[model samples]
Target: MSQFVCVRLIQGNGLDLTLFQFDYDLTFAAFFLNADRTLYGRYGTRSSLKEAEADMSLAGFRDALAAALKLHAGYPGNREALAGKQAHEPRFKVPEEYPALREFKLKLDYEKKEFNGCIHCHQVRDAERRLLRERNEPLSDRDMFPWPIPDLVGLALDPEKRATVKSIADGSPAARAGFRTGDDLVSLSGQALVSTADVQWVLHNANDGAKLPVRVKRDDREATLMLELPTGWRRAADVSWRPTSWDLRRMATGGLVLENLTDDERHEAGVADDKLALRVKYVGQFGAHAAGRDAGFQKGDIVIEYDGVSKRLTESGLFAHATQVRKLRDRIPITVLRKGERVKLTLPMQ
Candidate 1:
């Protein structure tokens, strides 16, 4: 803890807008920087909500800190190489700047009562989505899925070792790139890789189907390889396990958790095997999330069609349709089968 000048920011009190810039979805994160806040690199990443440290580790953190110090010693000599490591200009400078967050009492001063009216990290992501909804703009897939993990490209990196290749999926892009187990990633694209988050940043900025250059060290020898990404690679990532998925649920399904109907259930319902039939696993009972309940939707209902269309089968697909194709507050006609009776219902898109 005493290796460097460490400032613990517990409750977002007097948070520096410039220094604290990052994706709000992060549970725990750190910025290794010089006194002037020239970012050496970032040190936290997450792929699942249940496991906050799924993509980070203490060992990796130490390695990143040491790398930051190395960069610090080099300073202006390596300044050009580090320029792309910094964050881009944000849509809103501060958390309170968003209209949805403006009403909440927030502490602008950190020293005194740092916990007072502190805005939680998750709220920032929620607020950003709210702003887009208010502006009548559809949330792009990139906005919905941010900071995609390297696993999306078929590499399961060692969380304990900084940028070490642990396992590669068969026939995955990484395998196609000739990446073998035990190879330590030196850099990704053009950015120096101190931790997994740094790799994620490079992947996040890459265009779909872009061929990225990767440098790795194997048995004391360094080699450069080409990683060719195919179309729709980002869809391999799952967002249902994220904390922000609850908000997506409300916006897309009106507070209903849905699951794909089994083959037997589809047979009994007389629906085609290829048809879209999602069974209601659970329905929210109270508050804003209970819009499904308020709209007369009940547990055990099987949704066969949404907005007179029977194309989307999976919950994620339905969510994409609702949020991307439909506008906020739009009334969608949903057809469901309840207790051997076909029922027609209208659900208001939140």
Candidate 2:
């Protein structure tokens, strides 16, 4: 640890959005860069709050540091190859500069144990989405779900190791691309890998129907594969796990918390596996959150269909569908099962 200088940034008050781009919801993240601002790679990855540590490990971090030192030694000669790893042109220079967050201060008062004016990492995301929503612009896939984990396309990496494939989901894009267990991911889309977070950075910028070049080391031989992302692949990402979903709930479902029915619950409810059978777990009762309650939605109602779509969708998927397909204040036709009788309702988009 004494070999390199470490700087810890605990607040997002004056964060340079132009340079430090990453998953804002992550509890921990790191970047490796030369003195000249040439970034080597990034570290830190997480899916849900409970599993924040599942995708990262100290041993993996050590390996990444070693890899960064190796890259530093090769510096100018390898600068071009590191080009793809740098952040793209930013929309905003800093968190406070965002249209929705202009009221926040650029710095905090250190003497105060708690700075009420301080901006958090997650607020950066919330502010961006708010700006877009205020402009009545449709949110993109990346906005709805940012920094998708590797498992979305199906590659489970070991936390204690750097980019080592631990398992592959059956019939997934990774498997289709010929990714095998125990293979070490070397690079993706021309950028060298340092940790699982780097892999996500590549995926975050990728668009629909994109084919990404990937290289892996298997049995001491390197092999290349094309990761084919089909249309609507980003819809698989579940945003309910993110803290930002709280705002989404107000904007879409009117603060109604929906939960998917279990296997046994579905069977008893006569709902098929592929059908929509989400139960209304809770309905907010005040201000903007009271829209769900005012719309005639009950806590125990089982949602069978929404907006003429009947296929299964998680709460996050429902938010994505509403955001992409329906505009704000659009009344959606919905059917729910209440007390063994089918009831029709209208959910207003906030």
lDDT (Cα, tens digit) per residue for candidate 2, span 1-350: 66677999989998998789999888889999888888999999888778877788899999888888888899889887699999888889999999878998888877865558878888899888878777778899999989998899998888788789999999999999999999998889988888898889999999989999999999999999899988878779988878788878888889899998999998988888999988999999999888999999999999999898889989888888787788888899999989878899998886
Model 2 stretches with alpha carbons more than 4 Å out: 112-114
Model 1, 12-109: lDDT tens digits are 43355656665567789888887887887888888777787777888888888887778888987877767777777777767778787786555545
- Clash pairs of candidate 1? none
TM-scores for candidates 1 onward, in order: 0.88, 0.95
TM-score, prediction 2: 0.95
Cα lDDT, model 2, residue 23: 92
lDDT agreement with native, every candidate: 0.80, 0.88
